[model samples]
Target: MTSLLFVDDETKLLRILSSYFTKKGFVVHTASTGEEARSKLRDADARIIFLDLRLSDATGIELLQEFVPRYPNKLFVIMTAYSDVESAVTAMKAGAFDYVSKPAKMDELEIIIRRACEWLDMKQENRTLKEKISKMMQDQEMIGVSPAMKRVFRMVERAAETDATVLLEGESGTGKSRIARMIHRWSDRKNQPFVSVNCAALPEQLLESELFGYEKGAFTGAHAKRKGKFEAARNGTIFLDEIGEISLPLQAKLLQVVQEKSFMPLGSNQTVHVDVRIIAATNRDLKTMVEEGLFREDLYYRLNIIDIFIPPLRERKEDIPPLIEQFLDKQRAKYNKPFTLPPELIDRLVEYPWPGNVRELENAVERAVVLCRDEQLSIEDFPREIRHAKPDRPPSDIALDPTKSLPEQLESIEKKLILDALEQTGGQIAAAARLLSISRQRLMYKMNKYSIR
Candidate 1:
C-alpha cells in the first residue's frame, strides 16, 4: 500500500485528512509538530508527505531542505493559506513537489497524489531502461575475436552467473578494469553499486580507511563518520585493482572480509557485515608473491577461486583490427568527422607490437584522428616509435619453404625471430623486448602464448 504523511499544526485538519486518505486506501500518518513529523517519517517511510508551510516548531521549507537530499525518491507537497501563497512558492523552490493553498479541496489533493505516483513510476521505468542500455553499450565496447579472447569471454559469462570471487590476472593496460565492470553488469547485482579501488594507488593506512571506512573522530582529521568502499558496494561488487600491491598486513584484514564477509571500521568495534561480491585484478602474479612472502596465501587462495587470465593485445593479434575500428568509430563520432585509415597504415598497426596493449592502440587511433589534416590518416600521424618501427624480420630474410601453408610459414618466421632476439639479448626479457620494439610484458605474454620458455 502507498503511504501518505501530513505534517500540520492543526489536529482537527490532520484527523480529517487522515481519515479521508485512509478511506482512499492509503496508509496515512499525521504529525502536529516538526519533531513528531520526523519521528513519524522514520517509522512510516512515507512515499508522499503533505507538509504545512507553517509548522508548530519549524517551517515546511526547513524540513523540505533536510528531507529532499536524504529521501530523493519521496515527494513533498506543501500546504499553505491562500494569503501564504508566496510562502508556498518558496517552499516549492526549496524542494516541495507541489503546493496547495489552504482549505485544499479533496479533489485537488487526489489529483496531485495521482500525478506524484505516476511521476515516481515513470522515473523508475526510465532508470531501469537506462541501466539496460548502459549494459548493452558495454557489451558492444568489448571487441575481441581471437581464441584467447573467446576463452576469456566464456570465462566471464560463467563467472557472471555466480557469486564466486574472481581474480583477473593480466598485464597493465590489458583492460582488466573493463572486464571487471562487464562482470558486474552481467551479474545478478547489476542494479547495485560497483565500487572500484586501486590498491596500488594509495598508502596502506589511507587504503585501510578507504576500504573499511571510519567513525567520526577515528583519527586526527576524521571529523565525520564515513562509509567505506565495502559499505558503499553493499550488495553489489567491489573491484580491488592491483591487489598485489596491498601490504601483507592489509591482506590479512582483507582476508577477514573475504572469508567472513564482515569487517570493523576504523575506531569502531562494531563489525559491519556486507553482502558484497569481491572481484580483484592484478598485473603481478599473486601466487608468486605469496611464495615470496609478499602476499598472503589464504587471501590468494580465496581470491583465486575463479581465476581469469586476460591475454595481452600482442597475444591476441586478431582482435587488433576490430579494436582499432571501434576506437576509430568513437573518435569519428566524437570529432563529428569521417576519418579514414589506409590499408597500409592498418596493416602496419596490425603488425606493430602494441607494448601498452589495447590502451595504447586506442590512444594511437585517437591521436591519428585528431592530428590527421585530411580525411585519410597517414603513417606520419602516428607516434615516432610506431612510425619508425621496422618489422622483426622481412619475409625474404626468413627462410620460407614452398611446401608449407602461409600461416605455417608465418608461424615459423615468428618463432625464429623470437629465438634470435632471445639469443641476441642473452635471455634478458627486457633487453629482448627492447630489441623487438615491444614491451617486456608483451614479450613475456608472447613467450607464454607460443610456449617459447
Candidate 2:
C-alpha cells in the first residue's frame, strides 16, 4: 500500500488531512513540527510527503533541500498559508514535487498524489527493465556494433525464425556463444530455456552423460538420475560450444541424436525422445577435422543448415563507439559514479587490433571504470599493457623487460601501459579494463597500488 506523511503546525489541518488520506485508501501519518516530521519520516516507509512551509521551527524549503537528496525517490508537496506565490515557486525549485496554499483543495491534492504514485511506479519499472536488458546482454558474452557484427545480427534474426540447426564458426573469443544466445532470444522458443554445454570442457564419457543424461547407476559417481542438456533444453535451444573438440565416437553418437531427435541414457534401455533445436559453435576448422577422419561429415552437414561466422574484433573497428557507450552507461549505474569518456579515446580504440575480440574490449572498459578516480576518465586510468600498446612496435617492445631488476622495470612498463590504454580508450575505465584483460575491480586495486595517476 502507498504511504503518505502530512506535516502541519495546525493540529486541525493535520488531523483532517490525515483522515481524508486514510479514508482514500492511503496509510497516513501526521506530524506538527519539523523535528517530529523528520522522526516520523525516518520510522515510516512513506512514498509521498506533505510538508507545511510554516513549520513551528523550520521552513519547508529548508527541510525539502535536506530531504530530497536523502530520499530522491520519494515525492514531496509543499503547503503554505502565506499568500506569497514566490515562496511556492522557490519550494518547487528546491525539489518539492508541487506546492499547495493553506486551506488545501481536496480534489487537487488527491490528483497530485495519484500522479506522483504513477510517476514513481514508472521510474521503478524503467529501472527493472534496464537491469533485465543489461543482464541479458551481459550473458551474450560479446560486445560490438561494427558492420561485421551488424551482419552477424541479421544472420541471428534469420536463423531464429526457422527450426534449422545453426553452426557458428569463429576463432575463440569471437563471440560464437553470444551469437547462439542472440538466436535463442529472437526465436519462437525465447520464453523457453537455452541450455549450453561446452564440448571441449569435458571427457567423452562425462560429455555423453552431460548431453544425454544417465541413470543413477550409469557411472561410479552417479548418485542420482540426471537430466542432460537435451532434456533440459526440451522445446528450446541447445547450444553445443566448442563442438570441434568432441571425440570421434562421441561425434557419431551426437550425429545420431541430431538426425533422430532422440537418445537413450548411458545405462538405460529406454529411449528418450526430445524436441530440441541444436545451435552448435566451434573455433576449429571442422572441414579439416572431417578430412582427418576426426569429425563426422554427416554431423557437420546437419549443423551447417544455417551457418553464422562472427568476425574478430580486429576486423570490425567501427563498432567500438556504441560498445563503449553501452559499457560506460552500465558501469556508471553499477558503481553509482559519474564519469564520461573523451572523444580522443575512441580514435585510439579503433586503431588497436583486438586479438581477443569483443570479450577483450569489454574487459578493458570494465578496468577503466573501476580505476578511474576523477569525474572524467582520462588516459591515466587504463592498464599498463593497454596504455603502452603501440601499433607499429614489435612484440618485444610490448613485452615486459626482464633485464632491469624485474620489479622496477615492471612498474615502469605498467605505468606506460596504463597511460597508453587510458589515452586510447578516451578515459573509459571499462574500455581500458578490457584492453588490459583484467577485471575492473582488479584494475582499480593496481591503480591504487602503483599510484598510476
Q: Which candidate number maximizes TM-score? A: 1
**Per-prediction TM-score:** 0.58, 0.55
lDDT of 2 by residue, 179-283 (tens): 788788878999999999998899988899999999998889999999888999999999999999999888888987899999988889999999889999998
Superposed on all Cα atoms, the candidates' RMSDs to the truth, in angstroms, are 26.0, 18.0
Clashes of each: 0, 29
TM-score of 1: 0.58
User: What are the per-residue Cα lDDT tens digits for candidate 1 across 1-453?
Assistant: 889999999999999999999999999999999999889888887999999978779988899999889898899999888788677667766877777777999987987788778778867865654564445456764767677876787688789999999999999989999889988988899999999999999999999999999999999999999999999999999999999999988999999999999999999999999999999999998878988999999999999999999998988888888788788888888888888888888888888888999999999988888888988899999999899998654455666589999998887877788889999866766457767876545777888878998
Off by over 4 Å in 1: 1-140, 394-453
Candidate lDDT values, in order: 0.87, 0.82
Query: How far in Å is the alpha carbon of 413 misplaced in model 2?
Result: 42
Worst 10 residues of 1 by lDDT: 128-137
